[model samples]
Target: MMQNFILCLQEAALTFTLKKYLYPTDPSECFINPPCGCLNPGQEFQCEDCPYLEACLSSFKLK
Candidate 1:
């Protein structure tokens, strides 16, 4: 059961990463939403060009 849980987590992580749905200034700014379609991971190699998500990382959330 633990292994299954881990696998689910891995899959969710992959989906999230692949879609690059990291929070933007808002959901409208999300890449998968509108006006940002071309940057979908595996579809385009442009992750390096994106600026860091504003205050969305773990270090910021804990505060």
Candidate 2:
């Protein structure tokens, strides 16, 4: 029983770590090429009705 519990805990920890690595908790940690200058706080882009939406989305990359 204890061994199973330990395995479960390890699995949970690994899952959490993998998730953290796959998706950064902070938006500023994104790896975008050419950088989007129009990105507002909360990592939100003011792309609504913006002329650069296509270009911005094209170059956006997540680390």
Q: Cα RMSDs of all predictions? A: 12.0, 10.3
Local distance difference test values of all predictions, in order: 0.51, 0.53
lDDT of 2 by residue, 1-63 (tens): 999999999999999889756643544444333234545533555534444444334444432
Q: Candidate 2 has what TM-score?
A: 0.35
Q: Candidate 1's C-alpha lDDT? A: 0.51
| Model 2 deviation from native, Cα RMSD in Å | 10.3
Identify the runs in model 1 with alpha carbons over 4 angstroms from their true place.
21-63
Candidate 1 lDDT, 1-63, residue by residue in tens: 999999999999898887644445443344443332345633566643444422233334565
In model 1, which range of ten residues has the least summed lDDT? 50-59
lDDT of 2 at 4: 100
Instruction: Tell me how candidate 2 scores on lDDT.
Output: 0.53
